[model samples]
Target: MNRKTLVLSAVIGLLAPVLAGCGDSDGGSDGGDAIVVGTTDQYAATKDAPAPLDPAAAYDIGTWNILRQTVQTLMQIPRGGGAPVPEAASKCGFTDRENQSYRCTLREGLQFANGDPITAEDVKYSIQRTQDIKAASGVYALMGNVDALETNGDSEIIFHLKSSDATFPYKLSTPVAGIVSSKLYPKNKVRDGFEIDGSGPYTFKADVKDDTIVQATFTRNPNYKGDRNIQNDKVELRSFKDSDSMGKALDSADIDVMTRAMSPQQVQKMLRSPKDGIQLTELPGLEIRFLGFDTDAPAAKEKAVRQAVAYTIDRGDLISKVYDGMAEPLYSIIPSNVATHTNSFFNKYGDRDLAKAESTLSDASINTPVKLTLHYTSDHYGAGTQKEFETLRDQLNSSGLFDVSIKGEEWKNFRPNQIDGDYEVYGMGWFPDFPDPENYIVPFLDADNTLNSPYTNNTLRGQLIPQSRREADRSAATKTFGKIQDIVADDVPVLPLWQGKTYVASHDDIAGVEWAVNSSAELSLWELRRGSSAPAA
Candidate 1:
């Protein structure tokens, strides 16, 4: 398997003509200056997609980034992170005495971009839809605690949990639980087409096949009766086939923002070049990257083997090389900024101790002739991912611990292969749904982890998640996840890599840029103001 690349050039070109038309409403810029937002791929609205549209149902980071920016949800995390504030809701919390039931009061008269009223029915439809499409939904498990959902008197909606899930409200903050207009969406089927019926800050104007995705002036929504962290009137997203093209386009004033897919070396270069007029917004991410070993594979079955492989990795070097000092070294799958991170792995493995790797393998009667294949995705993460994996392979081969073979697949096929345990070892990433400690411990470490790939400590999955979810006091919940991290570090099911910082490169004309905790970071389009021209370097 090799890396998969899906280039959407034609779609971008078709959308580009209206790039300067951010104010014209008729699809031409009369705002004096249109903010040309650049991302790697063009937006294509497929039929029957959910409210926060995701092209690949498996939840790729890029798709999530687009969805969060393009759609408005019930609640959202503000810049600098803490408690989530209401976006569509006036105020959302528990109504029942036991806290088993959660309720959110809807903002009055809110309407979707297509003019459909955003009622409690839309919220119900959105939550229920996730379960209805469980097989295709990456967020099915996130909604498992939801035993029942009901709307009352048109203003309030209720959620009855199977257990007293303390973080249930936080889960609602995610886009996966976003509310969409029931009028335009089918309760049982996702509608197809290129038009958006979302209630976001910016409305979709045109998706010209491949070249660009254009949006016009933001009319202060009469029903937009809730809190939104934006101050911009219009936003236009221009997609390029690759980062190289996007960089050149930004340099030539063809686009006003460059958000993703730029190489670390390129980012460093831009940071040094005062004349480039590129702004980099770096924020700590809830995401952590790691290598998932196929414990079921004969070669990886023994603890000695996995532990030896873990010891061989130089995480610091990998971070510097792959992320250009934009990411922090991670010792646990749960990153440092998250609540339950433990450095037991870092203490145990230390800094790329090759001697320990050799001794561990030797003690287990394993020798140099050992070999296994590692896999990654082609276009999902940053540009240096392939090189990162190549470095890992060479490191292991050089340590004389194992002979490694490298392979990669496109994002679409990459996920299936990983979940199916088809590779001897594979790399994967986790971005927290909410900024909670439980979000870090529960999903990937759970016994029946969605991947179904086995790990040593089934106790964390079997016992910890339930216990943590049931705790009324969140601080008490911390103990459960903390214990989980300790056990997981000892088990060594996966090798911790790095925690990345999210960065966005916008043309100097775009302003009020910020970052979100969700690795699928959202752009606060309303807050963005475009100057008459790009700022002088």
Candidate 2:
């Protein structure tokens, strides 16, 4: 996922490729089906908002889905989940023991879909642009480790890091590392309109209406040279306004696949009463929904106020009311599935102790009923997000400790305002760029952390994070991440909420549905193919 939907997270750990009497794995039936995917996912490129398709500025799951199809990164996670391997690069690895300098050799004869060569210079430019624009989605935050970029002629690119980060390779594998044609994209300014040139698995074309991407079509790139298996010659991704329409489309055979709907109720319903000819497959995911605080905002600026809100939160009641048991209560920023998950908040606050909240404010000499404005996007995370926020507001208000009100807007406008600290406290979600403990903690804790919180701790960022980065074995960094989570609980900059499960609904005839979403939650559109025929409805 890209920023703020950075809209949800990535796909990893896949089910075996669907073996339902499938035929040839690549270019099945000569791409006659043109499988359509439906989602409520939306992004807009306003004058003030970041450019929609530009990899330099775009940083949300919706945008990344398009970029993943059209732009190839140097390194990519294997379809079944393992260490990343080279994509655009013939070979890539850290060149030094310190893990500070990394290098990649461009694959021979690589060319952008539009005919420009994908050179080392293009890799430098694409990564450089993301850092420069620092769009509201904040793709720049992910590249903070790179101190400088160097090119060796046209075939090689070198990255010098500020610290010895073993995870640097994983970062390089994300969509943010997608190599664009340097000749077309500007060095400093964000590219405008709907145009992109890359050497990924597919060439993309989008239909835009009123600055919104109405439909995105992915055609197999004949010029493309990469690691992906092009199973489908063409794929059409259609956007919808809500999950209901998406479901209807799937029912009416309008859409062959549907995902990105944050409706837990719908998930439960589908799982309970299975839909005939429609298979709902669940992917292993690490999507988290948390409340991000604008540390400079009025009441939320106070540590005690933030802590009180944290203490007032009842994750069980909140998840039950909003997610309907589809999501489990999360007590740490890092969910339980990740290594080093600790119930730091639960250990400190004990889940919805009203007296503790009252005492926290009282101890800080603050008055009762701390008024807070909670914010969220209306459409991005499915139709249920509004209800989730409303349920949270009512739950907190019922505690008589917070006079919480909500503000809902579209992703384009909400991201900018949230970045500018427009709301006292805002809702945010994370879909990791890679599979690692660093992916869970660093983005929200580091200087230039993407959450827009001014909160920082030298012990965590300057010491523990960099220390953890040097360890090749992620499990060895447990104690370091444990301390980081403890500091998060103590500071309460973000109120840990619930972790989400990802699901994809598709027609049974789609052979590769199980292999579609990779571990990082990225869509591998090239994997989808139509089998012989759909089962009778």
Candidate 3:
């Protein structure tokens, strides 16, 4: 991993009473045998659940987190940020000078939880099945360049690509590339239920849901042959509706740890006054939040109107007032710390100049008081989203150059509508599946992107991206990324708003905060442990 690992440097100044622990109670010296964690409800409800736990079908963060721990992949992301290292495979790398052919040799004696031998054929079958399904939301698009997979004996496997893709190995580090037992999964269709046979560190024990909560339990797999050390015998994951409820649970010691979906206000409050018995660890800023425009929309079709919208909004105020400085203003789709990230948008539209916006609109013959409706999810981006959009509405309307109205929807409904191009303009957030600049560039620029926007720049889609993919030297590839950012800045298909920092609030006695956050900015539950000093509930 490239970034330095974050650790619990200080305990909460204030002290609170410890409570009796709940759930499994096999031991008390190390805070008990089971650890309970809480997150937002977004993780629990699956819009497509009846289907099997197919690694190919798991797209969202919540499902991917679970799959990453339960299923093995060719390569795995390091704890901090850096290039992926081999996981199930003993070693994997490009074998041809063209950067189109890759090979992997698996470690011997690997087995699934059910005792099925893990072989090179299993790896080939897993990749083939995912590509064969061609699911709309699956990782097929990322692996589009892969032409064939061949296995030699039971240990060596080769992947031939249609074109050079230097980022292909990074794709192997994602949950979508999880290798499954061919004996357990079907080749033609998705699995019908959650019967998963994996070769990772954890085994799925049970998943249950009710009206108010969804819970999943996992146990350490005896067959696991990986680097991760499972500290707890079992881990229980619980999901709540919002941060407030989850915060209440944390206060009462109902949950040992809480990660993701906490409101900015809650995080700020915790930062100001440390609550006794709880410690907050702020992770690196690797996430980006932006507003995407539907290019087909009548108002957005004009490039001047889009540029005007971008120029009129103030990111400085949004960060200080709305986000409480928890985030930094973003000028590009790629986050700042990443290589090749440029401040293209900020260079073009400096300090939110209303005069420039007005001139752009006037030059394009776009009428004054341009009407636009901004769509956002009230439930998804935490409680601050409503105020964030409201602030945006105020900024645009105060300029006297536009008339803006805002609408709210839940994430489930909001995502589909945005993907279907139902909203003219909408707010969206992105967490990288892999820690690379290509991960930031390809998803939005690809012709078959999830944005569903009508805007298509063939130069970017066909030429520049492929050119960058062939360049193995990342530093050398920065020039191509710079050009791509300039194009995106000029087009204004999406306006980068801010990059977010990850936070994890855990009981003071809980250990391994540093290892819990992986390179991709996702929580790694297997790394969590309880200190011996923690009192058992």
Candidate 4:
């Protein structure tokens, strides 16, 4: 896949005007004065603030989005889409064909917003801190292959990997690998609170808190050295409790933009009769919602039981009734648009067959009315989640072969419990960190993956993933991916459900809405600007 090419084929209609407006000589001041963006309260910086802005301790997408603006990484995925390019580094690439050794040369005279020198040692320190801190939710897995870190001088750093991984460059592009100042942060401890000193397009200003809600504000970093041009002098990000409230804020012009956490119902309503002054941009679908089975659980331990549950699910009904056609059925972990995706689950299940499900359970000598609980986050996944889970429960219970109970938890509590294996089966959603089939396969199956499930297949985890990663040519790696999907279809550790379309609502005059959502579905706040013709507040 050519990572640098823009992949917004789905929203060309919404993008055309935005892109055209950017070149309009009449458009105001290149949108660098001020802008306000609204986000779901779930993403509010205060809701789950990562104190001290330590890159190693911040793993959540919300925190990473903020960090991406303030911290410079070795490479960065451009606003449209494409290969990871050098950001703070003057240039970076693998030094050995084995893909085991990577090197980077920092731009000369690089300095943080505070004017502190940024050197090769700082890059080495930043990567090492992630491994040393051992935070439960930190992103050490991305750098797990690092066998050694070496610095030749103030400008050059080298990495020796335990294994060859062609995907290392993409990993470095993530905010998780953001470089930090060795002078400011302690070598042995994580800094606490909101203080941040970095060399990026923006600088941390203040995190205003009101009870449980928090809003973060950032100003353009004048001392930064990078390619991104700040479209706004200052950015204020506000979080709302629900989509309805967020829509209201957008319609009323209380906020300039809103991204993520909007339900299909909310988006459809906006599309059908768009409020007079709001514009909605629909992005390509890159997110997947699925049901994960804790293979260690008594009921889920039996492959027959898991297979029965998969067979009983009515994906068509879930898409039509729950998502209202905004989503499509996903039969594999990899989204359909991605290379190597196959309808393995659908090919095996062949539509919901209750009779076949019953036979499968009977053959395994498993009792009927298998009782199980389904867990989901009420707030994090957006509206209709309760209804979505209710529909799922109805489908399984209607089969007469299962008794299902649904449960909902707030994200803060739900995430940890899910990681700790507190539920038998649960609903989970994934947003890709980078656009790669490996991202989908590796995270769910690897021995130390994000999913804390008890499912493990040595062949898929040990051989297929490493083999695929070693193949420089992505097209040649498709066979391995196909085999991995086949194994997932038989194992049924997780049932692939539906992939969703992304939506971003902004005031009618926001010029860069087209560029706001990158290929990975991350919101690029720096791309936003108020059009010259936008009405004054």
Off by over 4 Å in 2: 1-32, 532-537
Question: What 10-residue stretch in candidate 1 is worst by lDDT?
Answer: 12-21
Q: For model 4, how does the per-residue alpha-carbon lDDT over 1-537 read when each residue is reduced to its tens digit?
A: 001123443221011111322231221112235688877745322323344257776665666777888888888876666567888988999988899999999888888998888889889999998888755553677788888999998999999999888888888988768888877877767676666678887887655564333577778887788777667677877777888888777666677777767878777787677565556666667789899999999989999999999899999998888888578899999888777888999999978999999999999999999999999998877787899999999999999999999999987778778888889999988877776688888778886677767799989977998998887667778899999999999999889999987777666567666776654457666777666443221
Clashing pairs in 4: 3-82, 3-83, 4-81, 4-82, 4-83, 31-231, 32-231, 52-193
Count of backbone clashes, every candidate in sequence: 30, 22, 5, 8
On lDDT, who's better, 2 or 4?
A: 2
What lDDT would each prediction earn against the true structure?
0.64, 0.78, 0.77, 0.77
Please provide, for model 3 over 1-537, each residue's C-alpha lDDT reduced to its tens digit, 9 standing for 90 to 100: 011224211111111111122222122123247788888846423453444356876565666777877999989866544567888999999998889999999987888888889899999999888888865453566666789999999999999999898888888988767888777788987775555679888898546544122776778888888766667667777877889999888887778877777788888888778776677766656778999998889877789988999999899998887888478899999877777889999999977899999999999888999999999987766678899999999999999999999999977667667877889989988887776788787877786565666788998988999988888777778889999999999999999999987777777667765567543457677877776333221
Error (Å) of candidate 4 at residue 104 is 0.8
Candidate 1: how many backbone clashes?
A: 30
Q: How much does candidate 2 score in TM-score?
A: 0.92
Better of 1 and 2 by TM-score: 2
lDDT agreement of model 4 with the native: 0.77
Best by TM-score: 2
- After best superposition, candidate 3 residue 379: deviation in angstroms? 2.5
Error of 4 at 399 (Å): 0.6
